[model samples]
Target: METQRNTQSETKKSPQTQPHQENLKGTFAAVIIVGLIILLSWFGIFGLFLERA
Candidate 1:
């Protein structure tokens, strides 16, 4: 009975000891897209100002 309990506790702890892997490709792509949009908007406004000046 004690050995069974130890085995059960070890099994539970095993998963927590391992690192969790995540896929960040979508997250990276989203950040890049947002950055590009902000950059483009800034450049477009700057260009318009230059043209008017």
Candidate 2:
């Protein structure tokens, strides 16, 4: 029972790494979104294509 309590306490403390991980995740997501927008625009302005078609 004592070992079980210690294990639980250690697990709870590991959450300190989560904020740094979340920031990295946000940065990665932003990069991907911007890249996709640039690619789509370069393919030829999508709205103008639709208007002319």
Which candidate tops lDDT? 1
User: How much is the lDDT of residue 42 in candidate 2?
Assistant: 74
Measured with C-alpha atoms, the lDDT of residue 27 in candidate 2 is: 87
Candidate 1 residue lDDT tens string, 1-53: 99999998888784446678999999999999999999999999999999999
Each candidate's clash count: 0, 0
In model 1, state the lDDT of residue 53: 100
Q: RMSD of model 2, in Å? A: 6.9
lDDT of each: 0.94, 0.82
Expressed as tens digits, the lDDT of each residue in 1-53 for candidate 2 is 99999998888884445444334788889999999999988776877888899
**Between which residue pairs do clashes occur in model 1?**
none
Give me candidate 1's TM-score against the actual structure. Answer: 0.64
Model 1 residue 14 lDDT score: 44
| Candidate 2 ranges with C-alpha deviation above 4 Å | 1-22, 45-53
